[model samples]
Each structure stands twice: as structure tokens, then as C-alpha cells.
Target: MSSITSFNDSLMSHQNFVLIGIPGMQEKNSWVAFPLFVLYALTLLGNITILYAIKIDPSLHEPMYFFLCMLACSDLGLCISTMPTMLGVYWFDSGEIPFNACISQMFFIHILQAIESGILVAMAFDRFIAIRGPLRYRSLLSNSVIAKIGIAILSRGLCVCFPFPFLIKRLPFCRSNVLSHSYCLHQDAMKLACADTRVNVLYGLIAVMCTVLLDALVILVSYILILKTVLSIASRKECLKALNTCVAHISAILIFYVPMIGITVVHRYGKHLPPIVHMLMANIFVTVPPLLNPIVYSVKTQQIRQRICSILHLKRTRG
Candidate 1:
């Protein structure tokens, strides 16, 4: 269409597009692009392998592995949804995203983010039942129960994240189109809107509070109960074993949530920090979690480790 052509023309006119206007940060050269491209490839391959390993291994057909599979799937979705566009912007210096494409990316990014939060909460609840009421965990967390919860998590994520992009669509973008962050994050993207974005901002805050903050609170509560139950077991060996199993999950949760909270806080209060600092924090928030999730879960879960070994052998045999 004419509009598309015009947009493309505008993008083509600029040979050097700078996101932050820093002296050296103008347009992503191959140096930055190559490293991120490699990281993205590894993240995709690692998470997808974990997903398939969970699916094919009979020994991992339990609730924990089921949730782990779901987590891996969400991580894949997260990486694919954000990384390509980010890398494109960095690599080609093509910061000119079509309006529709930007909106679409925003939708998927928010949805996947919400799903990750919900899945983490579900995983925490699974741990709570496993530690607090092992006898009932099987009955309470059956395949049917987990299936229903997964459906609900996906549905709720889509429902909550839908309004965010829709709200963004309503706002007219007359100001600069360049985004502060690598990808089109909702809040950062909204900053470029020439029209009033009070409603979008308010709605986004509500969604984050309900989906991210509320889920985090529930995860914390589940862990608190799990810790209490573990302590009451009285056997030092048993306690250590239980803690060891959970240590990886706890560490992953901390790594994922801490930086997220850091970004939120810095965006709100630490405006004095340099743009590069903000950019670095945002990159960390996206990259660190996915890369670490498979490492932690696979390293901690015995069944997954064995399954991975089996798969690697099967691949070798086939080759």
C-alpha cells in the first residue's frame, strides 16, 4: 500500500539510525549483532531441545516435568518474539518497524511475559504441594489438573495482555518513532506517542500489578509454606535433599525476578542513570532468564539430565 511504501522510504532515507544518540552507540554494527545472534541461536536450540526431551522421555511424564516443558515452551516463545526484531534493529540499523509489526510484537511479548509469570507461579504451587503434602500431591496435581491449569494460564495471559496492545493502537504516534530499548516494549514504545497515553499507561500498570506482581506474591507464599514444611521434617539428610532440589528453582526465580524488578524500579525512580545503563538492564532482563532456565532445571532434575543424555546418544547413533 502507499502507506507501507512511504514508511519504507522514510526508513531507507536514514543511513545511520541511533537509538540513544550516544557518540559511539549509533546503529548496531556487526560487532554487537554477531554476539547477540549467537546467544539467540543458543537460547532457541537449548530451550527447544529441553522441550522435546521432556515430551519424548517417558520417565519425565510427571507434573514437575510437565510444568518444566511448559516453562521451556514459554521461554522459546519469549525469545523468538523479541530477539529477532531486536537483532534486526541492532544488526541492520533498521529501526523503522512498520506500525502493525511493532504492535504485533508488543502483543506477543506481553503475552509470553504474562505466561512466564503464571507458569512460574504454577511451578511454585507444584513445589508447595510436593513438599507440604507429598501424599496428596499426586491426587491434587494429576495430569487432568495440570492440563486445566495450563489452559487457564494461557487464557488469562492472553486476556490480560490483549488490552495493552489495543490501548497502544489507539494512541496516535506523531512524535519520533525510535524506541529507547532494543525491542518495542509497551512502556518504552508509549513514550514516543504524541497523543495522550495516560489511559494506556494506567491500564498497563494495572495489568503488571495483577499479572506479574500478584503472581510473584503467590509464588513467594508457596515457597514460604514449602520452607516451613521442609524444616519440620526433622531429618537433616531429608531436609538437605529437599533444599537441594529446590535450590536451582529458587535461584532461577531470583535471577529472573530481581532484574525485572530492577528495571521497573529504575524506570520509575532511577531516571538519572545513563541510557546505556538502562539499555543494559533491559537486555539482561530478557537474556539472562531464558539462558539460565534450562541450565538450572536440567542440572537439577535427574530425569531431565538422563533424558538429555539419552537424546544426545540417539542423535550420535543416528549420525
Candidate 2:
């Protein structure tokens, strides 16, 4: 017990944390970096293409495309936020992050995550409006209203995540300063603090409940209502057509949420699992959605796919 106490005391003023690439597998980080870099590169390319497609085509300036653009932007932000630390850990063997930098990193990550959740809800709402009342959808989700919704999503994320850094700053990290992943997470950092963290834990739960859980519940309800509306259509073909519009959004939701839920479940209940399992899930939760979102949308969204193909064809002809 004395040894433990002394160890804790020694780290009471820790200002740097060493982030991990893959737990107990540090020697293989260079190999791990190859796949991760590919994913990051693809994420950047796909999302940029999506944005460019939307920008060059005025026909795609509707509410749906606007929300899609927002989703792409948020995914890009998530990738950019984690890229530095992630590459540092894998490529350069440089995992040490200053206290302030770690706090800021966590803050940006959580805020962007919250924004992404809100954007998903917004997309669901867009689908609901389109299917429920196509005539009114134009007036209801006009450019002004869409802009306001975007601002609200950003504001809400900022407000909800604003306190996280401060809350984490107040806690005393008096133990091992090695984070379990390439990036800093609020919950991961909170666990190393020597002081009481009830407030941090409670607030973190509340934030998740308010942002992620609430957004998911809202999306589910929107889809339920959309389903009812679709069912009322007498024609089977019409019902299928209505459902087709939602395929991309549903794919995006599953991509983001499944890995997220996997990470949560693994962290909470998979104590017996190998540490690599937990690390893999954490990395996937951060990386996979961004990599896959654009591809899913491109393949499932006809307009985006056509625009991208034409753009590629034009470049080829020019070359």
C-alpha cells in the first residue's frame, strides 16, 4: 500500500500523458499505421469529393444535400482532430501530450461528436419532412431555416461540451498517465485522476444522455413516424420508393452508432476480453465512421454518385 501511495504521490503533478497506439503491441504500431493512414486518406478524399459535388451542382442545394454537407464536414473534423496524435503514436513513437493540449483535444473531439449526432438527427428530420409532406418540405426547410438549424447544432454542441475541459482540468491526475488509445477521451482521462470524479462522471453521463442518447431517440422517433406515413401509401412501389430515399441516412446512422455502441459495451462489460479488443473498438469508433460515411452516401445516394462520376469523366477527358 505504501508503494502504491508513493507512486501516486510522485505523479500528482503530471503534466504529460503518453498515448498508446495499441495496448501491449507497441512494436507493431508501424504496421498498424499503414492501415490507419489509408483509412484517414480515404476519409479525406471521399468527404472532400462529397462536398465538391454538392458545391458544383446547384440542383443539389436542397435541404437534404445541405444536411449531407454538414455531416461530411463534421466527419472531416473528427478525422482531423485525431490525426495528429494518432500519427504521432504510430509513426514517430511520440505519444506524449501536454496537459493543455490533451484537454483541448478531448474538448474538440467530444464537441465534434456531439455535432455529428445532432446532424444525424437533422438528416432524419429532413427525411421525415420529405416523406410526410413533400409539398410543405420546401417551405418548412428553406435555406434560412436550414442555416438556423446548422447554427443551433453548433451552438448546442459548444454549450454542452464547453465545461468538459475545465472539469477535467480541475481533477488531479496522480497515477499512470498513459492513455489507452491514440487520442484522449474524457472518460479515459477522468479515470486517472486521483481526486473524486463523481461530478465529472455524472456530467459526462448527462452530456452523453443529452447529446448522443437524445439525438438517437429523436432519430428513432422520426423514423417511426416516417414508417407510419410510408405505410399509409396504398401502392407497394410508392412505399419502396419512399424507403429508398432513406437508405443512405440509415446506413450512416448504423455506421456511426454500431461501432460507438460496441466501444461502450466493451468498455463497460468486456473486462475479460483482451486489452487489444478494447483498443481495436476504440480505434474503430474514431476512424471507421469517417472513412465509410462518404462511401455509403455516394453509393446509396444517386445524385451524388452521378455527379462524382461525371466529374471523374470530365477530368479524364481533359487529361
Candidate 3:
């Protein structure tokens, strides 16, 4: 307890923080940057292609594709948020970040995450409408309605995440200003504070519960209702077709949430585990969803697949 008080007494507002990249793999970071760069580039390419395809293809201008475009936009933002710090760490060995810049990065990262979760929930509702009431789907999700939904998603993300940086700013940091991951995360930044963080902790918990957890629950319920609708179809072939439409979305949800949950568990309870384990999970959580979502959609979504194929001039052979 005395030690804690001593640290608190010495606490001063730090102007800069150092990001130690890949705790034990400093020597191999230069080499590691190659694959990471490739993955980032591919993610950019995939998401851009999805957006472009939807933009040019008139047949793709529907509510489903609009939500997809929103998802791609969020994925692109997530990539941009993490790219500089991550690549800088591995490629140039530059990891020092100013306090305000760190706060900005942390804000964008969390807000984009919240936005993406909301997008998934929106997409699930789109699917539920499409399956549950195909006739009313178009009328229900009209252009104005979709626009309003998009606005609400953005507004909710902004409102929920805007307080995070301020919360961190009010706390004094006396502990070593080194973060666990290469990029700024709210939890990671909060852990270095020398003051009482109960408010921060409680607020963070409320934010996660309201956004991510609530969004996941909504998605799950949407799918369960969708499954009931699919099962009610009279023909096996029709049921299979309806279920297939959801495969890409289900894959996206799994990739995003599974890694997110894994990283959370590792951060909270995996102190005895290797530092490398934590590093890898953080990287995967941010990187994989953007990299794989487009791929999954391209393969599972037929119109998108054909549009992409035509754009690439790849001839599809009839089976």
C-alpha cells in the first residue's frame, strides 16, 4: 500500500508513451512486417473492391449491399486506425506516440469497433427482413429508412465512445508508460493509470455491455428467428437456399467476436501466459475480420462474386 501511494505521489501527466512491439520478438519484427504488410494490403484491396463493385453494379444497389458497403467502410477505418502504429513498430522500429495522438488513436479504434458491431446488427436485421417477409423487405427498408439507420449507428458509436479519451485524460499515470499491444486500446491505456480507475472501469463495462454485448444478442436473436423462418419453408431446396444466404454474415460475426472475446479473456486472465500469445491475439482481432470478410462475401454472395469476376475479367467456366 505504501508503494502504491509512493507511485501515486510521483504521478505526472506523461506527454509521450512508448509502444514496445511484439514483446519478445524485437529482433524478428523487420521480418514480421513483410507478412503483415501483405495482409494489410490485401485487406485494403478486398474492401475497396467490394465498395467499387457495389458502386458500379446497378443490380447490387439494394439494402443488403448498402449495409455491406457500410461494413466495408468500417473495416477500412479499422485498418487505417491500426496500420501506422503497427507497421511503424515492425518496419521502422518507431513506437513513441504523443499523449493526444494516442488518445485520438484509441478513440478511433474503439469507436470504429462499436460502429462495426452496430453494422453487423443492422445487417442481421436486413437478413431477417429479407427472409421473414420477402414481400415487405423492400418497402420496410426504403432508402430513407436505411439512411436513418446508418445515421443512428454512427451517432450511437460517437456518443458511446466519445467519453473514453476524456476518461483516460483525467487519470494520472505514474507507472511505466508502455502498452501491451502495438496500438492504443482503452483497456491497455487505462491499466497504466496511478489513480482510482473505478469510474473508467465501470464506464467501460457499461459501454461494452450496451454496444458489443447487446449487438451480439440482437444478432443471435435475429438469426434464431431467421432459422425458424427458414425451417418453415416447405421445400428442402428452398430451406437450403435461405440458410446459405446467411453463411457469409455468420462467418463474419464469428471471426470478429471470437477473436475479440479471446483477446478480452487473455487480457483479463492470462497473466501467466506468454506475452506473445497476447500480442498475436490483439493482431488477429484487428486484422482478420477486414482481411476475411470480403473474401467470405465474394465466395458466398453470388451477385458480388459475378460482379467481381467481371471486374477482374476472369472467365467463369460453366460446370
lDDT (Cα atoms) of all candidates against the true structure: 0.80, 0.92, 0.92
User: Rank by TM-score, descending?
Assistant: 2, 3, 1
lDDT of 1 by residue, 1-319 (tens): 9998886665553322224322256643555778888889888888988988888877778888888888888888889887887687678775566666777877988888889899889989888888877889889999999999999999999889988778877776655566777776788878876678889878888999989989989988888888888999889999988877777678767867888898888788878887877877887778878888998877887878888988899899999
Q: After superposition, how far is residue 5 of candidate 2 from its true place, in Å?
A: 13
Please report the TM-score between candidate 2 and the true structure.
Answer: 0.96
TM-score of each: 0.90, 0.96, 0.94
Candidate 2: tens digits of C-alpha lDDT, residues 71-156 = 99999999999986898899988989998999999999999999999999999999999999999999999999999999999999
Runs off by more than 4 Å, candidate 2: 1-9
Least accurate 10 contiguous residues by lDDT in model 1: 14-23
lDDT of 3 by residue, 1-319 (tens): 9987776555643678777677977888898788999999999999999999999998999999999999999999999999878999989999888899999999999999999999999999999999999999999999999999999999999999999999999988888888888899999999998889999999999999989999999999999999999999999999999999899999989988999999999988999999999889999989999999999999999999999999877534432
lDDT of 3 at 301: 98
Extract clashing residue pairs from model 2. none
Q: Pairing residues by index, what is the TM-score of model 3?
A: 0.94
